[model samples]
Target: MPETFLEVGIAFAGIALASLVAAQLRFPSIPLLIVAGILLGPAVMSAVDELRLMQVFAGFGIVLILFFLGLEFSVGDLLSGARRKVLNGLLDFAINFSLGLAVGLLLLDLSPLGALFVAGIVYISSSGLIARLIFELQRAARVETGLILSILVFEDLVIAGYLAVLSSVSGGTEEAASFLQPALALGIVAATIGTARFISRGAQRLLERIVSDELFVVAIFAALVLVAGLAEMVHISSAIGALLLGLILAETGHVERIEQRLRPVHDIFAGVFFLHFGLTIRLENIQAVLAAAAVAAIISILGKTATGLLAGRIAGLSFPASLTAGLTLIPRGEFSIVLAALAVSAGLSPLIGSFTAVYILILAVAGSLLARESLRIAAWVESLRRPKGNTTSG
Candidate 1:
């Protein structure tokens, strides 16, 4: 047991160190954390042995992260009919999904289920990371930013539905037995959403009564755990449930206070989770599969770019703006890893898990660079569109 603690402690130390370096380097800490995980994990130095429990903990952390993410968006914004914008988001997902599944089948030679898994990977965009990057960009206040945000919101919905479907596919026996998985999953979602609204009101009263910080923390985590457990019982992603839970709680006035207290805890656990993920990678296996992973990564980027651009155009944006918006949303992280983990947990595909991990690592590096350089791209585009000549017509 002491050894377990020691391994966990060392793993955290690695995360801290790597995170600092990544911050200093202006690179996203995700890949660095994974690299550190690889170093400490059994595959490399054999220093960390309690990987199983760490993975479980990390899974919980992912739920918390996604749950908070869901809380950040305004549900009303989604409900607003912005029909063209909404269609753009859906079209982006559909186009990319089709392209990716085709590639998976033709190039990767995966099974039908494997192909669907690949499509999920390709269709799901990382709105969280991309949104943050957009916020950080100098041109974030420009019209492009608004369009990007709109497109990302649409993409997130696709991801949410994808997650629900994936969870059903992975965990639901009834889903496998009948053609009712989509319908059943939809029913579960409607019930969950409706129940969440009712419970959130009461939960706000209870959360406000807690005076002790420790107790507050306990209650918060307990809520997350309870919601996650329920989600798993119903054959859905706990992260999805957690996300919905956060969104529900977001409606309460006290959400800001709760978030303030929970941020530190979320950070600690999330950092560890990312690092632990890195540690799980088998470096040798990744090396052997590097070529395939790289190919998949390229396919992911191209397919997303094409789909996003087409969606932007369809949404009534100009060609240049649409192209820029599409390019901007190409970065991927976190959600892909979660999807891969869910697949592995449900025994849908082990190969997908291994390959997807490698694929995520590649994206984390390349995507961060592109996101950081988005400002440069935005500036160049600004430079290209010369205003109407001030001089008299020739």
Candidate 2:
């Protein structure tokens, strides 16, 4: 009891110290939080023992992160731009997912199931981390921001289906019941989205009656948790449910109020989420898979960057905007880890987990750094593309 409280207190202190350093260096605090976790994890100090409690906090962090992103835009926006979002999303997924599968199959010689897991890992970007980056960098108003959100929403939708399929695959059952699970999950998500889109106003009116801040916060939190739990019960990602709830709330005019109230809660839990991710990784396992992980990470970065560039262009962004957009999508976090853990739990390959941990660690840090310097990279690329004698008068 006392020991648990002490360990948690120390962990929080470590996170606070890491955050302080990150602020001084003008770096994203997420990667630093992860590093702090690594230093204090079982592989190192083994100072924390309440792993389950940490996971719960981390889970809430992810939910809040996605939920907040969903609050940024209304259902009408998604519906109006559905075509563009869908096309860009398909293109992004086709390129990156294929590259990951190919690398797993040809380069690493993984089994079909293992390769599919790799595809899952590479297909999704870290919405939680990217959302934080966008806020930290103050890029929310940029032209490319909408396109990025659209693509991320699409990815979240796809994950719902992907997890369904993965569950069936993992169970080693070709039975009809196994196939039905994915369908059932997708159906539930579709229904939820539809309800949110059509009946959002009614929901909002009901919510508006609660003028008390304390009660409002409790109600919103409970609703989110309930929806997320329901989604998980259907074998869909709980984050998707939280995101959809945010989207629903976005339809109302209360987004700002909700966001302001939720920001503090989001920060604390989100920090735990990143820290827990680092704690799960075994340093020694990473050493054995370093080369392969490096290869995968490089391919993932390039593939994602290309996808982002193309998607941004499709969304009518300029070269620099597109480049920055691409760079922003390079980090792979929560979903990738979930897929990798799924693979390991299914008894596919232990290497998948280690490789994923190292791969995510590298990209999360590098992606944030690259996004910070995107303008410089964009300028460098633009210079190379300019004609030799194209210097213009100012």
Candidate 3:
């Protein structure tokens, strides 16, 4: 860690600067932080030379990200939306994933599993980016806002299942094909989540006795990490373990205390995670993948657009609002990077990493600009549908 101090320090500095820029621009920080990492990291200027240590720390970053994501929604919330939105979520996954798979196989020349990774990368839209857009674009009060957020919620649950089948207990061994043990992995994840919720029956009584904030932090933090470690031991993804831990602990009704005490730690590690991923990208490598990334981005947008439109129609939204929803769902971030890291661990082509980096840059920047103008675009579309006799003179 001492030798790693320079690399670590530079990473945080990049994170700070990126955050400031994103804040000033009133934009989401994901893209800024990622670009900062790429520009400041080894591939470009060799500012942060070593990666082994940062890789270790970034592990904590991902576990925390997945855990906190789980905390934001509860089991009841998932159950409540299962009937109405589950089909829409499935449609979203199918459309984007199919497009990604075809592109990965045909254009990128990836194998089935690697193509699965690509599909995963394209399947889910960026929840953090979209949430910020909803706020900054002043669409928080709009009806479509709730629909968008609901899609995110549904996607979160879907990913839990997707990752379950996609993960292997052996970490990322290349020979260990993940598809070989779907039943076992899903069984383990289901059992672990079930066990956590079952234990929550008495968790409240235990948590209430921890009167000191410091003690509570230590105790709860230990529990979260311990569950994650144990899950990893059994060949389940540690991230899933962290998520299940959050799901179970949420029922304890102490979520507010846990979030308040631990969020800063989560934020710090999250920055490290994104920044480290950025550093691993090779610019020359990106050039080889850039064309593929561009085509993938276009296909991804079209797929998501179709899903959003069909879902909107099923939910009885107006045509313009449907188009707006489709456009806003164009961006992908966070989880896609996480998937690429997992692929690297699984010994997939290193090109996958560069490919993801380029794809994210294209979508995050282009997608935001498109989302901001989507409403205007939708209004124009609606105007096109108007009758000439009904047109008003300006």
- lDDT against the true structure, per candidate, is 0.73, 0.81, 0.82
In terms of lDDT, the best-performing candidate is 3
lDDT tens digits, residues 1-394, model 3?
6757887788789999998998898777877777887888877987887788888778999899988887886667767867777777878877887888888799899988888888888888899888878778898887777678788888877777677667772254545554456667787667756676677778888999999999998998788789889877867788888888888888788999999999998988998898889888888888899999999888888887787788888889988788878888888888888888888877888888889888888898888988999989888988888886897769
lDDT of 3: 0.82
Instruction: Give the residue spans of candidate 1 off by over 4 A.
Output: 173-182, 194-196, 315-320, 374-394
TM-score (C-alpha) between model 2 and the true structure: 0.84
TM-score against truth, every candidate? 0.88, 0.84, 0.94
lDDT of 1 by residue, 51-131 (tens): 888887798779878877767754565577678667777777677788768856876677777778777776676775676
Residue ranges of candidate 2 with Cα displaced over 4 Å: 107-110, 128-150, 160-174, 308-324, 341-350, 386-394
Runs in model 3 deviating more than 4 A are: 169-180, 193-196
Pitting candidate 1 against candidate 2, the one with the higher lDDT is: 2
Model 3 backbone overlap count: 1
> Best to worst by lDDT, what's the order?
3, 2, 1
Model 1 scores what on Cα lDDT? Answer: 0.73
